[model samples]
Target: MTELLSDQRIDEALQGLPEWRRVGDAIERSAELASFPQAIEVVNRVAERAEAANHHPDIDIRWRTVTFRLSTHSHGGITEKDIALAGEIDDVITDV
Candidate 1:
């Protein structure tokens, strides 16, 4: 199992991910797409990536806004996996 990230490490990771913020034991980011469909499209793309990474995030969709919350539940806190997936989510956003 992956180890949980330290607060210092989590802060460091968020430095590069301006869109994502540390929220308690998890990190979250919200994106506003062009339209509702566009938002769903991004979610679909994120879903694919999440599947590929085998690290699924909690997704909340409301109209054109989609929020993703990442946490390694099994590990009991945030971890490198969540950070890596956050980076991937950012990439997906720009690619969409």
Candidate 2:
């Protein structure tokens, strides 16, 4: 089984992810795009990366804003996978 990350490690990892914050056992970030279609495009891009990594995040969309919450459900907490995917998601947000 994948091990859950320790609080210290998660904190350190989050240092580089300014837009993301710890929320209980998961980390979350929300991005606002110029239009609803652009927000959906970001979601679609994130979906591709998540599928490639075999990890997924819970997503919520509200018009031009999208919120992503990631956790390693199998481990019941955050893991390196979540951190890595967050970075990938950041990249997608930046690209779009």
Candidate 3:
């Protein structure tokens, strides 16, 4: 299993991911997509990645926006997995 990241490590990772923010013990970002279908597609991509990593984010999808909040529930805090997943999501949506 992937190990949870330390607080310091989480801080360092968030530096390059400006859209993501620390909220309580999780990292969060809200994405405004072009349409609801596009948002669902984004969610699908994220789901594939999460399944592969065995880590998942709490996702909320609206009409044209998707919000992702990630945390290591087992560890009761943010972790490297959350950062990695967030980065992956950001990359996937960069050209969308």
Candidate 4:
């Protein structure tokens, strides 16, 4: 089982993830893609990465925008898994 991250640790991790911010006990980021298709494309890519990491995020899609929220449900808060997945999501977004 993963341990929850301390607030200070989360803060330090957030520095490297400029697009992501702390929301409650989760870390989230929203991306605006070129179109609905592009948004779905990004979501698909994120899904692949999430599967690879064995960690999934809550995804919300509206038009050309997609928001990803990462948290460890078992741990009931943020963890290193969330931070790492957020970075992978950022990389996936950059690739698309």
Candidate 5:
């Protein structure tokens, strides 16, 4: 099984991911897009990245806003995978 990240490591990772926050065992980020279509586009892009990585995030979309909660479910906490995926998500959002 993948190991959980230490609190210090999680904090260090969050420094690079300013928009994401730790919530219990998961890390989450929410973005508000310019339009509903744009939000969906971001979600679709993130979905493709997530599938490619085989690490999925819990996504919530409301109107023009989308929230992503990522955790290594098998390990029951944040891991390197969550941090890496968060970076990928940020890139996708920035690109889209």
Candidate 6:
């Protein structure tokens, strides 16, 4: 089972993910795309990564913006998995 990240660990991870912010026990980020279709495509990529890692985020899709909030449910908070997946999403979407 996954473990919850400590406050210190979460802070350290946030340093590497400047685009993400802590909201309670979750990490949140918003990415803007060129169009709705492009936003959906980004969601697809994030879904694949989430499934592969067995960790998922709450994704909100608007016209051209996608918001992601990630936390480890089993741990009742965020974990290393959330940070890693967030990084992967950042890498994929930055190139889009």
Pick the lDDT winner.
2
Stretches of candidate 2 exceeding 4 Å from the true structure: none
Clashes of 4: 0
Residue lDDT tens for model 2, 1-96: 678999999999999999999999999999999999999999999999999999999999999999999999988999999999999999999999
What are the clashing pairs of model 2? none
Candidates' C-alpha lDDT:
0.95, 0.97, 0.90, 0.96, 0.97, 0.92
Residue 78, candidate 3: how far off, in angstroms? 0.8
| Model 6 lDDT-worst window of ten | 71-80
Worst 10 residues of 5 by lDDT: 1-10
Comparing 5 with 6 on TM-score, the higher-scoring candidate is: 5
lDDT of 5 by residue, 5-73 (tens): 999999999999999999999999999999999999999999999999999999999999999999998
- RMSD to native, candidate 6: 0.9
Score candidate 1 by lDDT.
0.95
**Runs in model 1 lying further than 4 Å from the true structure:** none
lDDT of 3 by residue, 1-96 (tens): 567777788788999899999999999999999899999999999899899999999999889899999999998888778888999999878857
lDDT of 5: 0.97
- TM-score of every model? 0.97, 0.98, 0.91, 0.97, 0.98, 0.95
How would you encode candidate 4's per-residue C-alpha lDDT over 1-96 as one tens digit per residue? 689999999999999999999999999999999999999999999999899889999999999999999999988999999999999999989988
Off by over 4 Å in 3: 1-4
* Error in Å for residue 42 of model 6: 0.2
Give the per-residue lDDT digits (tens) of candidate 6, residues 3-92.
888999999999999999999999999999999999999999889988988888999988999999998888889988999999998987
Evaluated at residue 3, the lDDT of candidate 4 is 98
Please list the residue runs of candidate 5 whose C-alpha ends up more than 4 Å from where it truly belongs after superposition: none
